[model samples]
Target chain A: MEALGVNLPFLLVQIVNLIIVYTVITKWIVGPIMGLLEKRRETISKGLEDARVAAEARANAEKEAAKIIADAQAEASKVVREATERAESAGKDVRAAAEAEAAKAREAAMAEAELERNRILGDLRGQVAALAIAAANKLVGEALDEKKQRALIDEFFSGVKSGKVVVVGESLSGDAAEVTSALPLTSEEQDVVKKNISAKEYAFKVDPSIMGGLVIKVGDKVLDASVAGKLEGLRSTLK
Target chain B: MKRVWARWVVLAAIILGLFLFTGFFGIGLGIKPIMPHVYLPGEKLSETPLFGIAGLYPTNTLVGLLLADIVVILIAIGVSRGVKSGKTVLTGISGAVEALLEMLHGITEGTAGKWTKQIFPWFATITLLVLAANWSGLIPGNETVGLIHHYDHGYDLKQVGPITTIWDEGTDDGEHHGEYAIVPFLRPVSTDLNFTFALAIVAVVMIQVFGFRSQGLGYLTKFWNTKTLFSKPIFGVIDFGVGILELVSEISKVLSFAFRLFGNMFAGAVLLFVIGSLVPVFAQSMFYLLEFFIGLIQAIVFGMLTMVFMSQATQGHGEHHEEAH
Candidate 1:
């Protein structure tokens, strides 16, 4: 009556309306939206799982590639080492073959020199005997016999100097040392001694079949005055 | 059939109880003024007319009707609660009542569904309550209280005819002077403008509430409804005039709701009173029947108008006007 102030009925109506609207919307709209959000959450989780699996697969592939590369590198290194070792061994084999061939060539040269020396010694022996008989006949004015000459040669060899000398004969006795005459020492000889003498001396035996010549050696220096040596010098000059 | 008879018996018993209560209070008591008259605030209770307005005022009948309306609405809600979704007594009543309300709501909601839902409950409740209050006054003895008379001047007196006065005025011969009296036995609620004005204020305030709830503070601008008033000078002037008009219209709603119901019910009561006074027996019965129908029709009209005005106030003016057209 007093201008119809706020009343219980109006308040009740407002409250009732609010409740009805809230209930209906909660049942219909909000519930459906919540369901949609739940589905979206599941989808996102499945997507995350798929991404994780893909990442793992990619990592495995990378590891396998790395392993293959490592294996290839190891194999390549082993091949290089084997090839290098084979090349080194081939070089060593070539060196060994060359040395053997040089040794055989040196032995053949030494045998050939020995055979030539014997043939020259045979010719020199005949010349030296003839020259000795002529020299005796000139000195005594009479011919001497071969036996007596042989005995005299022995006596002269035995009476010569006991130093190193060269004997030119088919065969030299262990005691043979004689020469036709003792030669004077020349300036050349002294020079040879100064130039060629070594601090340590070595003795060398020459098998010379030229019996009339005397050969003397001191270290590497040699003096030869024999029929074979004279005939080799003559042939060299004529040619 | 028994259930129907039982319901009628209960209704009759309640009616009888209300009648007996009224009769005991109305007829058994003999006061100095046998008929109760009211002195409104700022109104004199003398037999002399004040500014040509009636001197004898009635009790505030609107208060009782308002109280009864509240009780009726509460009972209606309780009864409706017993109703299930599609089946129940209230649902059947609602099916009949809702046909017209639904049609009105459809029109309001055609363009303003969003706003109407906010105000529909208050609008429907107010309409139904006011309607029930108005119609209840059509019952017998509602406007038929016995008549009594007071002295044209301000004195108590002894009785002159069959009507006995309880108080006397001094006489010239040292004897008491007697005065004639007339009194009635019933009164109707709506016959008073105060009751109708109260109802009108409730209806108008409810319209404002719906408007505010629907559109918030913007609803105040409905009185000043204009587009680009400042930009176009001539249209601005017209808009200003229209704003004044809108204000006048809102002021007129108080007069409209109050006077319409008051005039109708008062006229009906006066017609019945005149006819029954002229021909006591048959005219009383005939006019009583006429009053009953008039009361029902007026209640329906008042409720329907409240509903329409409230819906219109809350809804978009352009759409509703177009739909009305």
Candidate 2:
């Protein structure tokens, strides 16, 4: 044991030294290390918690932004829809007003055109009556009676014979009467036609297209004794 | 290019070292490497005891112990101060100590459970102290530079540039210079039986303390188990015998623990020098690496065994003993 250096005092010294080392280690090394570990664990957990909070906050922010954007889009669409409706309504009103104005102008133009045609046809009737009178004077080798020839031409053009409308066979009564003649009727001819058809109002029109006849309309009934109507009847009978 | 210059520099250094140490081609100091005398015990530094008492003289192992202690304490201070300064992590030696201790703490917690707080300090202390002592041996001049004393089986001393070294004359003829031996100033304390036995004794005592602390007076029943001695026939006698054997094993634990660390570290130190003397150059570097690994392993093993025994003592004796069987 002496050769191995296991003397009593040195062994004792080492034991005492061991105790001191144990004290130093426990107080300094182990205690601080444990505390540091615990603190590190705390720091890590706190970091994770902060990150979680930030993430949640970011998610909330994103949701709110999405909601705001949706609201803005909805408002924009609503504004756009309202603007479109207003524009369409404004366009519809302008179109309707324009159509009404066009219709009124067309009606005025038609009335003026009818008056002009009737005046022209009236002038043509006078010339045709004069020509017929001269031809009658030649055919008979003598001058025909002037008043009688004038009456004959008036009867042929107005479809009125001896101051009575030949087209009105039966007595007619109505709220209004419309008379269409081949030429513009003189006042005397209009008074004769009105006397045949009883109505509240009278309208006189001349058309050369009807040849030498008169057409009368009282309410819904019409009396057709125009030359053109006679020719259409002959054609149907032939077919 | 940088790496290439470094290699050339290393090659130059190796040649220079060879020339200086070996005196190759009759240049430089003539080589006279003396094999150091192997001593089992730590040689005393002086004839008079430091404490002014017989057998209380200072020894080279005592110097080694102080060096190891200073290293451990300095590291402890650095780690504590680093942790105290609110740093969760440390660097350098403090970092290394923290890493090692933290690993040890994890192991202790896994094994010792609640008793980890009580048991882990001893584990740390022993590992650090033994580790420091073992590694200190690897320092270049630890077993070489010392006080020369006259002896029958020694070498002649030579003075070169204010340094004294052991010299061997080439011829066997009696020379003008005398023979002498060296008592190295520093030796690894782990090679001392006193330190190992002291550590072992403390560890075994702590094991019992944990046993008593955990089980109270019931722990004594493990050594003198009269509870089942007469109740059953064959198994009761066997249990009594086992209890007595457990008492015997406790004493054996001290012997095993002490000698295990001592034998390994002392043998490693001796192996290093023996290999160095046989092939004095870079061959010993390989064995140094070997010694480094062995030192780490032995330190961990010593600490782990103590921790296991302590944790075992803290458990129910009957259950664990049965489990052991």
Candidate 3:
């Protein structure tokens, strides 16, 4: 053992040295290194967690942006639809007003034409009376009275004489009566016809198709006093 | 291309100069390499005691211990400073030491589990000390440049410029002219039996400390298993015998640990010496590399074995647990 150098003194020195070295290594080396390693690991995991949170936040922001954009688009389209509807309704109102104005204008033009036709018919009635008086003078070989001839012509065309409807038949009582004449009636003639009809309401009209006399309608009854009706009666008696 | 040629030229000249200085072809002082004398004990440098203690003085292995201590201290300082500065990664030597110890720590965690905190320091320290001591031997002038003393059968000394080396004086008419030998001032501490024995004793003592720590006084039952002795008469003798054998094996473990490191390191040193004396030049470099690998393996093996034994001590023996159930 001595030859191999295992003396107590050397062995003691080495053991003490080992203990000292162990302390140095444990305190100054191992402890700090392990702590550093653990800290590094923790830092890395925290950074990863932060990155993950950032990514999640970014994703949520993108989704919210998309939602807001979609809502804006929907609102914009709704505004466009409402504006289009208002424009169309305004166009329809303008068209309806234009149609009403055109209708009123057309009605006024027809009333004026009716009034001109009535005046022309009144002038033609005077010419027809003069021509008749001339023809009677040639036939009788003497001139007739002018006032009597005028009166007779007026009564024949107007279908009224002395403020009374000469076409009145029996006692006709109804809710309304319509009097037709070959020429437009004067207001006094319409009033005479209304009184003779013994109805609540009266409508006067001119129809040249009646030829000369009046055709009075009371309820469903008709008093055909036209010259065409007299001619049809005479023809039937001759046959 | 010209610079590359010049570099090769300088390198060849250096090799040729080495061959000439080492007396390759018996020219230029004709230095002959004498096979170094292998000593088991660390050779004392002086007759005087270093601390006035009888039979205790400064020796070559003690010098090697100091060099190894310096290396370990330097490593410790580098690591602590690097870690203290709050660097995420250590650089240079401290980085290398950290990487090596971290690997050892991983192994300790795998082996010892929860006791790794308590166990890894011993593993780290023992491996570092042994590794430093073993590698310090490989330095030039270690076990080579030393004191010359008179001996019965030894080599003559030669001086080549400022350096002194031993060379064999060839026989002249069947007579020897050399009567002196070189005693190196530094030998690796791993090659010393005292260091190896001390480490082994400490490791074994720690093993028992862990055993008692883990199991209290029940650890003694591993070597004195009497629980099964009275329970089963037929197997009682066998159990007692096995317990006694466990005690014997525990004693042998210390010897095994000590001699295993010392024998491998000592033989490696001897092999390098024999190879140097025989080939004298480039051949020793190859063995030096070989010894480098061997030294690292022996250091790790010593520490690893200690760790394994210590870890084993922390757990109850299987038969004891089985018998308890």
Candidate 4:
């Protein structure tokens, strides 16, 4: 130990010097450096946490934006569909109204045509009565009163009423004409009417609606000799 | 970027040119044979009056130790100054100091755990101080430039270096200029057993203190457990014997810690000296690098061993013994 220069006092002094160094190093160096490192670590960790939170917020905002866009699209489609349905129903109403108006006008025209035909028939009846009277005067060589004219026409129409209208295809000797008139017919007038219309049985009929017209009937067939009948045939042919 | 690379190439070329120039010229390399110095008291560089007291002066190794202390203190002050003022970022020398302390702290913390806070100062102190002392020896004039000494028969030479001085070449006339040795102004502090032994004493003492603090008076039972001896004689005898062995080992720790650092550092210094003398050129440079590594390793070993011993001292010896089994 002596040869190695292990001085006792110097060793103690070195130990003391080391203790002082230790004291100084611990107080000033290690303590502050460790604290700084810890602080930096905390700052870094906090920054990372803030970044995480910001990223989460961004994601949430994106989600909300997507939802709003989806809702707007859905609302737009619903509005479009509702508008289409309304337009369809409105078009249907318009078509139905136009069709109803056309039907109404057709019915009115038909009624007017019927009324004109009836009026024409009434005018023709008066003329036919005058003509029949003139014919009777010439054929029988008699002046007939209002009652006699009615009797003469009735006798002629009685023959037509008994199914005595002769058909063109059948034999005229077996068929007879039954005439209807507004007035009575005389026996001579009846003979004249019979000579004009062939029949197996002669019958005469009177109707006030016919005024002075003559109508002959044979089975289901009817022949109009009156002015009213001639006018009705003329109106049917015009239609 | 091209400019920066060109600058680097220019700088490297300059360095290579300087190296080649110096290598050829032998401008700095000392080609003399660097003999190993014994682990004895260094030759005196100067003598102080000390109020007329005898044998009061600074030896070469003592000057070296003081110089090492100054360097360490400067480094410590540099490291502490900015940190003391609460600065967050450090740079340059302070940064290096902080890095070294942090690394040492990490290693010590693993071995010492919570006790590291209490023990780290001593650990760091020994390491940095020893590291400085060890590296100080590698400087150009550490054991080279100093006072010249002449051996005399009338004077007690044993008080200085080894009685057998290699540089001594006695003349026929016995003139003082006949045989002499260069007593350098500085020698590495760790080359002296005193420094290593002192540090070891400090470490071992602290360990004992930690043991007492942790386990109370019961900590001494590991050295002499009479209670076990009375209960189980056969096993107790072995236990007591092991306890004595443990005590011996504890004492031996001081010697071990001292010799381990001293031997490694002292050997490295001698090797560098011898290699520098023999090969001198690039060969000594490689040894310098090796010495630097050895110095660093020796410092770490000293500090880590202290920390380990302190940690073990705080624990129960029985548990440690069981673990060993």
Lowest lDDT block of 10, candidate 4 chain A: A159-168
Off by over 4 Å in 1: A1-239, B1-63, B70-74, B77-81, B84-87, B91-118, B146-186, B225-227, B318-325
The best-first sequence of candidates by lDDT reads: 2, 3, 4, 1
Report the error of model 4 at residue B101, Å: 3.0
Off by over 4 Å in 2: A45-166, A182-192, A203-208, B1-34, B170-178, B233-236, B319-325
The candidate maximizing TM-score is: 2
lDDT of 4 by residue, B1-325 (tens): 9999988986776555455334456653222243534436555567762345455356776777787878877876776677666676778887877788788888887888888778877787778888888889888777766655654322112232533433323345744343445577788888877778888888898888999998898888878866568677787789889889988998999999989988898788878877765554457768888999999889888988888888888766765664563
TM-score for the first chain in candidate 1 comes to 0.36
User: Once model 1 is optimally superposed onto the true structure by TM-score, how far is the C-alpha of residue A237 displaced, in angstroms?
Assistant: 99
- Cα lDDT of all candidates, in order? 0.52, 0.87, 0.85, 0.71
Error of 4 at B252 (Å): 1.1
| Model 4 CA RMSD to the hidden true structure, in angstroms | 13.5
The candidate with the higher TM-score, 2 or 3, is 2
Q: Kindly report the docking quality category of candidate 2.
A: medium
DockQ of each: 0.00, 0.61, 0.49, 0.29
Q: How does candidate 3 score on lDDT?
A: 0.85
Candidate closer to the true structure by TM-score (higher is better), 1 or 4: 4
Compared to the true structure, candidate 4 yields what TM-score?
0.62
Worst 10 residues of 3 chain B by lDDT: B23-32
